[model samples]
Target: MRPGERAVLLGPGEIGEPTVDDWAAWSDTLPHEVVTGLGARLHRHLRPAATTTLRSL
Candidate 1:
């Protein structure tokens, strides 16, 4: 590990968008202390696509 560097795990979702369950499962595999320290902000960069009203309209 390097200074100011964090570890990231790519989830099974397309484009790496981890669902709530996926995130929970991944966190469950890690040590309690590690998960606690990292907090919810972990992997915050990944996001699901937003919906638009005009889609399929």
Candidate 2:
């Protein structure tokens, strides 16, 4: 999604906003080292997806 755009995940039921503890729990479910490595790879892969917008004065 673009900046300021809203996104919703459609599943069997509505997913509510996550709390700090919820995030902590979710993080605990994943392998931290693997997740961190994947994050770095994803960042490298998606970095070029960012673009700059120009406005005329």
Candidate 3:
């Protein structure tokens, strides 16, 4: 949203060291356009759900 700002993609594994193959396989299943769209809207998609006492991990 600002100049020089950047985004990082991490997941499919633990905090310290995330696995790469899992994410690669999953991405391969989706179209390039869809993946690009998700990258742009990643914040909205990862937002916490409302009305939750303690949501499942």
Candidate 4:
């Protein structure tokens, strides 16, 4: 990992109740690193595109 390296953080299945509170309640279910590893980067929590993720920031 380095500066300008884009990483799309996504969940393979339903990570939570589509809300932060629900997820936090059972935070153990999620990988511990998911919370601590994020820095000042762009993050989009959504379903990944079948081909490529194209959208407007």
Task: Give TM per candidate.
Answer: 0.24, 0.27, 0.22, 0.25
Using lDDT as the yardstick, the better of models 1 and 3 is 1
The pairs that clash in candidate 4 are none
lDDT, candidate 2, 1-57, per-residue tens:
789565432111225744333444666753344335444433232223144657464
Q: Using lDDT, give the best candidate's number.
A: 1
* Per-residue lDDT of model 1, residues 1-57, tens digit only: 998785455444556656444666767754444436657766556545464335241
Q: After superposition, how far is residue 24 of candidate 1 from its true place, in Å?
A: 0.2
Ranking by TM-score: 2, 4, 1, 3
Q: In lDDT terms, how accurate is model 1?
A: 0.55
Q: What is the C-alpha local distance difference test score of each model? A: 0.55, 0.40, 0.48, 0.48
lDDT of 3 by residue, 1-57 (tens): 687575445443444433344455676653444445555535642545354466354
- Judging by lDDT, tell me the better candidate of 2 and 4: 4
- Measured with C-alpha atoms, the lDDT of residue 4 in candidate 4 is 81
Residue 23, model 3: Cα distance from true site in angstroms: 2.6
Q: Candidate 3 regions off by >4 Å?
A: 1-12, 15-20, 29-37, 44-57
Is candidate 1 or 4 superior in TM-score? 4
Order by lDDT, highest first? 1, 4, 3, 2
Question: On a 0 to 1 TM-score scale, where does candidate 4 land against the true structure?
Answer: 0.25
- Top model by TM-score, which number? 2
